[model samples]
Target: MIRTGTEYRDSIRDGREVYVNGEKVRDVATHPMFKPLVDIRARIHDMAHDPATRDVMTVTQNGQTNAIGNALPYTQADWWAKRRATDTVLDAVGGIVTRVGDETVGEMWSLLDGAEALAAIDPQFAPNIKAHIAKVLQADPFHVSANTDPKGDRSKAPQDQDPDMLLHVVKETDAGIIVRGAKYETAAAYANQAFTKPTIANWGDAALSDYAVGFICDLGAPGLKFICRTGFATRAQAEDYPLSNRFDEVDTLVIFDNVLIPWENVLFYRHTQAAMHIRATLHRYSAFAFVQRSLKLADMLIGAALFNVRQTGLDKLQPVQEKLAQLAVWRESLNAHLTAAIVLGERSPAGLMMPNQSLLYAGRVLACGQLHEMMHIARDLCGGQISLTPDAASFRHPDTAPWLEKYYTINDEWGAEDRRKLLAFARDLLNSDYAGHRLSFQMFAQSPPFAHLSAVYRNFDWDGPLSLVKDAAGLSDRVLGAKTLTPGDSSLSKWFATETPKGKAAK
Candidate 1:
């Protein structure tokens, strides 16, 4: 069922223990650091009900309406609809905000893909995954992800060091399993729930280890304390740092002190095989949404740089246009990867449509690995003015207003106010401390760069290249193994042959 803005806001006021900057947060929904993003998330909910946006934000299923972002993708059309819905939210919000909900809910779908494997380990957990996937469609809770744990020592096992460093099962009762540890999660303080699970680690040969666990954690549950980092919103004026004020998704160190996880909520536990499977394929479906955000960021970078160059009539210069072209190349490269991934979508183990994993992961690497260089290009195009511009307050002051106006105003068409606003935006997007955090978020948000490359290595069809080289070099038959190796048959025609997906409600 779809929730309204008011209902979504009211749901999070569950008296969850939360703190920021050493101060106790009385109410997350109204807190200065969190309210902007909370309101943006609420707006996303309202979009599902608003008449003009409802068509784009929600879908009908079995005569019932559900959030488009929460629906399980079964066809290529489902993916397209999901993409459109996310774009609609970002466009409406006027800034990029990851971890809102859509970017994270797909992680559950990844788990669903391994239901059969999980059932082999524990039959009870298989059904739990399906139930939770359906629950997301029915309940539409604001979901986020929790994976990174603060490991005390890399050299020691979780049992040797402080066990709490990595979240572990402390005890099991008839009611549920009590867990203790912490996870670094974004937007956990204000979100309704998180798909809490183990971080990347070697599980050893043990079949059943305490660290092998995954569950749906209710954020408001007792004994969960949200210790969030100090937010950028309260640190600066909105006019000077607009993106930080409205779009900073405050990350939190959620302390799980003997928190109870109901049996029904446990997706998997004490099964290293299950844990390994999840760790391997956790981002299969979610990477699409994560990479999509980079596409949007690329657009922002292009727009800011192009506008800057054109404002000063620098677009006519050879060097400036070349820089602009370079930005376009990066932007379009991302667009190509996203569009191609959807066009050549592949079916998952569970029969759900997954974006072609190789292309999707390769796209992720290109978008993230080279983002800082592109930002530098944008920073160059925006010039020294972005860093030197005075704040809005300085422009409004009696003594300084005239001087800023005289220096900032280029022509009658470009007034002082517009120029100042543009500079402020460019500065925040590329030079502010918040900008550095965003860059880091892109680099490691989905996983580290090495992990992303590892996904590419695992998904890419290596045999195709190997066979091509073998055939060209006239290699012996034994090198081809038992089966004959053939070159891959991937092209535009193959993608075009795939059936088009129907609308969600129609399906």
Candidate 2:
């Protein structure tokens, strides 16, 4: 069901403990720091009911309307619809804001796709996943993910160090299990729930352990505290830091002090195999949305840089054009990867469509690993003026206004105010603290760079290359006997053989 903005805002006003900048937030929907994003999220909910955007933001299912983002993607069309819905939201907000439900809801879908693994552990777990997926569609609550725990002392196990270092079960009661630990989650303060699970770590060879647990955490539950990092919106004027003021998604360190997860909310518990399975395929469906953010970010980089160069008539220069082309290459490279991954989508173990893992992960590596360099290039193209520009207040000040206008005005086409606005925008997009945080988010939000490489390694068709080399080197079958290079060995390798294009040019 689709909820209005007011309903969405009211839902999170559950008197949950939330703090920012060392001060307790009385109302997250009214707080100066969180209100902007909360309003945006509420607007996203209202979009499903508004006459203008209702069509794009929602879908008809069982003769009832539901948020498109919550719908499970069963066909390629569903994925395309989800992608378009996300882009529409970004366009409406005029900037990128991750962790706003659509990006995180797919985490549950990944769990849904792992029903068999969950079933192997406990029969109840698979049904719980299906119920949660349906709950998301029916209730349309704001959802987020919880993966990275504040793991202390990596060298030592949880038993050696503080047992609470990693989120583990302290005790199991008749109602549910009480877990103690902390998780670094984005939007946890305002979000309704989080799909809490294990991070990227060694679970060890164990059949059952308290540390290996997964559940749906209600953010408003008792014994939970949201200690968020200071927001960028309240740090400066909106005119100076446009992206930060409106698009900053404040992350939080959610402290779970013996929080209880009712039995129904527990997706999997006391099952190391389930935890390992979840860690392995956690981002199968979610990475598509995560990488899509980078695509929009790439466009923002190109847009800000191109407009700056063009405003100064520098676009005509061959060198400037070369730099512009480089930005386009990065943008389109991301575009190609996303597009091709969808076109070559694969069916999940549970019969759900998943973006091609090899292309999606390789694209993630390219988009994230090279983002800082791209930002640097954009900053260079914008010139030193971005850093030297004065704030909006200085432009409007009575005494300094005239001198600022005289210097900032480039030509009749580019007036002082326009130039100032553009410079401020470029500054925030490329040089501000928010810009750096965004770059880091892209690098490590999903996982680290090394993890991205690992996903690519696990999914990529190594045997195809191996078989080609062995055949070219005239190796005997005995030498190549121990490997699986056949087409039907795996679903992805099968797609690599049939769906993916061939020939040297294809490479």
Tell me, by lDDT, which candidate is best: 1
The 0-to-1 C-alpha lDDT of every candidate, in the order given, reads: 0.90, 0.88
Quality of model 1 by C-alpha lDDT: 0.90
Model 1 over residues 1-507: C-alpha lDDT tens digits? 798888989999999999999999998999999999999999999999999999998989899899999988887788889889888899999989998899899999999888888898899878888899898889899999999999889887788888899988989998889999999999999999999889987666788889989999999999999999999997998999999899999999999999999999999998888888898899988999988999999999999998888888999999998998988999899988888787677879989888889899999999998899999999999999999988999999999999999998988788999998988999999999899999999899998899999999889877767777788899976897786775542333334454344322233
> Model 1 — which ten-residue stretch has the worst lDDT?
498-507
| Stretches of model 1 off by over 4 angstroms after superposition | 489-507
Task: Please give each candidate's TM-score.
Answer: 0.97, 0.95
How many backbone clashes can be found in candidate 1? 0
Colliding pairs, model 1: none
Note the clash tally of each candidate.
0, 0
Worst 10 contiguous positions by lDDT, candidate 2: 498-507
lDDT of 2 by residue, 211-281 (tens): 88899998989999999999999799999888899989999999999999999999998888888888878
